[model samples]
Target: MGRINGENRDVVFEELWKLKIPAKSSVFAWRLIKDRLPKKLNLRRGQVVVNGTLCPFCSNNEEEAAHLFFNCSKILPLWWESLSWINIVIELPQNPRDHFLQHGNGNVGGIKSTRWKCW
Candidate 1:
C-alpha cells in the first residue's frame, strides 16, 4: 500500500484494537469509520425507500452518518451523559471523522483507558 493509505489504515486498526467494546460493538464502530453503515440516507442513495430521509431521533434534518451518531437532538444528550459519568466532557463535532476520533483516544492507560472507549 501507499504510505498515506497504510498510515490511515494503521490508525483505524489501532483504534479498533484499543476500543474494549464487545466484538459486535467494535464491528459497528469499524463500519461507522468506513461510512458503510446502512443509515437512512445511505439506503436512499442506494435507491431504497425509507419513507422519510429525516433523522429518526430528531426528525429535524436528513438522516446521515454524522447526524445520526453525534449531532441528533436526542442521542447527543445520552452520549454526553454516558461520557460525563466517566468525567469526559465532549462537544460533538459536525464532521463525522472528527466525531469518531473524539471517542476514546485519551493518553490514559490500563483499565481506565479501556473503559473510556466508546460504546
Candidate 2:
C-alpha cells in the first residue's frame, strides 16, 4: 500500500471523496485506516503470542483490516451511516484499502464531523 502523505495524500483524499467514501479530513481518514487494522496487527496493542488475539469488534476471528472494516458487524452500521450521510449509495469494496481509496465525483458538502469522529 502507498503512504497517504504529500501528493499521495491529496490523491487518496480526493479519490476517497470522489468514491463517496466520505469527505472526512485527512487525519480522520488515517484514523479510520488504523481502526480497520486487526488488533493483532497493531503493535501498540502489544505483542501477540500463544493464543491468538481476536478482534475486539468480532470475536469470531482475528481483527485484520479486512475483517474490521468490511466484515465486522459492529462496523457495518457505521460504514452504512457514513455513506448515507454523504448521500452515497453503492456497494462497499471487498478490501479495506480499496474501500478507503474509492473516489466519486458527487457533491460531498454534506459530510459530517461526527462521521469522522466515529472512525
Candidate 3:
C-alpha cells in the first residue's frame, strides 16, 4: 500500500485502473496488490480458524497470496503460459505489488502494454 521502492502508488494505481477489464477483476487485482485477499496466511493473521494453512494446491507451503499466485509449483505453469506470449521469461518478484509491476515490464507500449498489465 505504501510507496514501493520509491515507485509512486498513485501512478501504479492509475495504470491499474486503466486496464480494460471487468470491475470485479480490477477489485481482485486491487486486493492482490494490497495483500487484502483472504489467503490462508491472511486469515490466520486475523485469528480466523481454518482447517489448515498449507496451500490447498501444492500443500507444501503456507498459502500466502504471494506464494499461491506467484511462487506455487502448481500455479507457475499458468503464469508461464502468459509470459510465453511475450516471448520472455524472468524471475518473478515474491511480493504481489512488485510482481504486478514487474509482470508488465519490457513490454511493448499502447494496447499491448495495457493487456500485459491486465494479465
Candidate 4:
C-alpha cells in the first residue's frame, strides 16, 4: 500500500527532507538506509581490524545496522516500548531500507515522515 513495499530504493537518495534533522543523526540514518554504515560486520568484511563482528550492545550476533537498530535483544524491546508510548507499535523490518521506509511511509514528505527517517 506504500513506499515501504517498493523495491526501487534509489529514491531514498532523493528525500532531502530527512536532512532537516540534526546533521549527525541524519547522516547516521542515511548510512543506515543505504546499508553503508560502518558496522562491525562491514568493517571486518572490508578488511578493517575488528576483534569480532559481534554486536557491542548485545555481545551476540554480527553487528549489522539492522541488528544494531531493530533485532538486538537489548534494543528491540526498547524500541517497541518507546513507540508504544505514542501508540505506534510495529514489527520492525529486518532490512535497513525497509525499516526506514516503514517509518517514512506515513504522510509521505511531511516533517513527521522526515523526522522518523532521521531517527
Q: What do the candidate models score in CA lDDT, each in turn?
A: 0.73, 0.58, 0.82, 0.76
What is candidate 4's lDDT per residue for 1-119, written digit by digit as tens? Answer: 45586655476666633366676766776787778988888888889999988889989888888888889999988888878766776788887778766776776777666656665
* Per-candidate TM-score against the hidden true structure: 0.78, 0.50, 0.83, 0.76
Best by lDDT: 3
Misplaced by over 4 Å in model 3 are 1-9
Clashing pairs in 4: none
What's the alpha carbon RMSD for model 4? Answer: 5.7
Quality of model 3 by C-alpha lDDT: 0.82
Model 1 Cα lDDT, one tens digit per residue, 6-104: 754556557676765788988887787778899887888899978988887778989888788877888888888987888877677786566655554
Which scores higher on TM-score, 2 or 4? 4
The model with the greater lDDT, 3 or 4, is 3
Candidate 2 stretches with Cα past 4 Å from truth are: 1-38, 41-51, 105-119
Residue 29 in candidate 4 has what lDDT? 65
Clashing pairs in 3: none
Q: In model 3, how large is the Cα lDDT of residue 66?
A: 90
Query: For all the candidates, what are their Cα RMSDs to the real structure?
Result: 2.8, 6.6, 3.9, 5.7
- Candidate 2: deviation at residue 75, Å? 0.7
- Candidate 2 C-alpha lDDT tens digits along 10-107: 54444444433444554555555546433576754656453555778778877577776677888888878877876767777776555654532233
TM-score-based ranking, best first?
A: 3, 1, 4, 2
